[model samples]
Target: MIRTLQSGQQCQVRIASVTGESTLLYSTHRILLEAPNWTLDGRSLILNGDGKLWRLDITSGTLIEIPLGGIPDLNNDHVLAPDGESIFLSANDGHIYRAPLTGGHAQRITPDDGSFHFLHGVSPDGAELAYVGIGGGDFRQPGRLMTIASDGGAPARVNVGEGHCDGPEYSPDGKWLYLNTESFSTEPGHAQLARIRVDGTGFEQLLESKTVDWFPHLSPDGQYASYIRFPSGTQGHPADLPVAVVLVSTGDWKTPLHTWPLFGGQGTLNVNSWSPDSEHFAYVAYPPATQTED
Candidate 1:
């Protein structure tokens, strides 16, 4: 059974597995739903819609709203903590929060700093949080990759070149944090995939190309990494575009084991969504709505 809201999204939401099977899990007609994070048990998916969060049961295809009382301005930037006990969310106000996985009052982790913080991933041991921080309302400016204590404290900037750094994910072992950086806001096409240490050192470039690459998620088994690539000259990964999800061998796995074309870019797979077994991952696709004769 495919569920849809009558007013919000321009298209429908789909759960596409790596085995090439895609299903219409949910949709909204009034509010746009974006960004999905998989559960550690692989039984459900948690996503944000209308400034609130929802849990979608993978087996029953049911949608349940998580009661986020205090955090009314939640964004798509969220990830399940490694402990599988709590969830961290980046609200629209640019502050980070920790809440119960089942949903409740969220505790703000970052202070009321002027800079905006959008969370990318939580450390393996769930102690550090890596995110991109920058001045608010100016999306064109390059962002800095930084980390903070998961509980709440001053943030330390990761040692990366001055550029637009985003989509920071930690390796399973908590040694390397993978991220993408592009020099100058003028040349957005130069985005390259790279990884650095949690202490802000030992940085190395992983992949570089003319095409813009964003959101690289390593598999749970520590064998492969998957990410999304955008077309030439696109900035900030605009929505409703042709994109491909590429899978690469992490530790001598291989290069480009699989890449699938889809119709979503920015909010498709912003968080670590690999399943527990490491066989297939989950991603959302926004397909175009049927043309109505206007």
Candidate 2:
């Protein structure tokens, strides 16, 4: 349920529920991990830890290191292809990459000159990837919602004029991509839940509020969306804050059915973590900020 972090505190990773209860899946020894994806088979989970990818066998309690040949540092920005044969990830250099799900050398997808690249979603057909990139602009470097071919090519900006767009996950049919875009507040980036088409058309706001919202993940059955919410006026999704994972019906996108508390903020739910059946989701919560010396 909980493991000691480098900070000498218990770090928790939970398989969260929409309504009733949530249970702990796995934990590590002073090694905090980010992002949790139940494999297509539903027997194991894939997560990034200690700057490399790890496959945690749920039934056997074994951990196998997934070999990413070239990238020495992996971030929270990673996703499994829909077919579960490929992986798309962002390395420390802020460039996108693609590697086989079985694990091997990674081939670069984005230019090496960029400052930040976060791989949020892979389309159903595995032909396109929606991600966030900071660059392509002058000083101050704003983030953009962009999609690129899985074979590696230039990224096309998805929203025409939307500002600070992040977390782009595709609809089950691949027609719409859900994401979050920020508005101006007393702080710099205050996010909202939204969606757009793959062709960069049909840009519409799904949920608008004064509170900061991010990571809009659509269910596989096309009925609901799960996302995380931070307190109003929070500049960004920072760590160790009082946060909640709120579920909303896709049609209304306003009223929430459940609100679950957490001790994490940034790496809690950065990627699409819904189960194959689309009934449950996954999220990570940290130890308190006060603990540090494991």
Model 2 Cα lDDT, one tens digit per residue, 151-194: 87777777635467788888999998888886333346788887
> Every model's Cα RMSD, please?
4.1, 3.7
Give all TM-scores, in the order shown.
0.89, 0.89
- For 133-178, candidate 1 gives per-residue lDDT tens digits of 9866476677888899999999888868887888898998988898
Which residues of candidate 2, in runs, are more than 4 Å off? 1-6, 113-115, 136-139, 160-162, 183-187, 289-294
The best candidate in terms of lDDT: 1
List the pairs of residues colliding in candidate 2: 7-292
Question: In lDDT terms, how accurate is model 1?
Answer: 0.78
Q: Could you tell me how far off, in angstroms, the CA of residue 286 lies in candidate 2 after the best superposition?
A: 0.8
